[model samples]
Target: MSSKFAQNRSFKKNCTAFAAFFIMSVSYCQTSTYGQFWNEVQFNRTINAKWSTELNLGSSYSSTETSSNIFENNIQKSFRGWGHYYLSPRWKISSFVAYYDNKDVPEIGQFKSPEWRFALQAIYYFHKTGYTLSTRMRMELRHMRNGDDDYENVLRYRQQFKYLQPINSKILRKGVVYGIASDELYFKSGTKVTGLSFFDRNRLVVGAGYLFTDDIQLEFAYANEYLPRDNENQIVNAASLTLTFNNLLPNLNKKLLHKNEANTNED
Candidate 1:
């Protein structure tokens, strides 16, 4: 009876959070809003008990109400690589470098220059019986060439709160479906940011994921973005999809070697 009651409480809490996120997203549509779609593919490899790495490639597309097709315009393409070290089961630290080819501005011409970014991140996890909560703090250094062909540098800080709950089991594992939600805030500081506000933007996401196997998973989510500018604020309603592969190459190689050994024995 106690377990059943707890499950009911968890469900209610999740429903409430989802409802609030949906309402906020709807309210943002009253402003200068646009629609976007982001797709990403990630590869993860575990090097040892304390070390891991990830590579991610992603693209973004944008559309306005008058646009004929939502995906007709490609706004951004990016690649990022990360190296992680585990301090313990509950803490992790990482560093990453990223490159972005941005074509979102018509005034600047398409893909005229690119952005380079580097970040350091730390995460702390709170483990509960049925769910996990975490916070991530990241600091970023961004470099890009301005219209005058001079290099501009900016510093940004980001903080995010994330929650994960397993639907079918006590813990997240292979073949389990899970619910996830996160909210992130961004802040900017630098000489180039003199005219802009210190508060950069906010991103909120609500999503679900299905673990197909130990090596692969897929996630789909709705993301709401609010960015404040000097003249007009921008709102983005985005759909995001991510596919993750774990130890893909190593697993495939192992299977191939096993098959070859079997063939040799048969001969």
Candidate 2:
């Protein structure tokens, strides 16, 4: 297990180095939409027979449109705290609150416009495996505050439908695993000068992981996203790695069996 995990770490480091070199060598024109790159620290704790909680914290830095002529480096920090309720064997309900920021770093004395989004999600499981279908509705409030510019209340609605399928090993003990996901995002309020009038953003991600033990899984992924507006479109390519430690590993097997029995009884 340790050897497999070490190999996975080596792979992640190599991928990160390649991505960094590729981006620095080229000059990107137009707008770039980068997917989140920070490592995720997530743990799941079962509270009772029907309730569970997930906590996550992550951060990322990327390049974005600075102004009309230049580009500014952007950084985003995301913290997520969510709860899941098992309504039935195949049905579940989850909700999360996320904070996002779009900051301008080049301009002197420039402030940041942070956005807060609250989302309620519903998920349906296919079987004992990880195959699932998810629908999410997010209500967003963007507070655009700057030292030089004053903007009004930005209210937006975002809805997404996603499908998740496992691409790696099915056995948890083997450690090497992958999940492929795709989603379509719809935006209501147009952004500032980017001239975005209701765009379609589609994302494809491949998550690869190697488990060190029942308690720890080290993961890496390559993701791409395309957002097309009326005339202009933004393209993004991002790579990231995460190390997940399952604090409640001793209970996972018991819970898995319980979850399986629940599904069987429902069936």
TM-score of each: 0.83, 0.61
Which candidate gets the maximum TM-score versus the true structure?
1
Count steric clashes of candidate 1: 0
lDDT of candidate 1 over 88-196, digit per residue (tens): 9999999999998877532223344578999999999999999999999999998876555666787889999999998998876799999999999999874432225
Whole-model Cα lDDT per candidate?
0.85, 0.62
lDDT of 2 by residue, 173-196 (tens): 545455645465656566452234
lDDT of 2 at 238: 67
Error of 2 at 73 (Å): 4.1
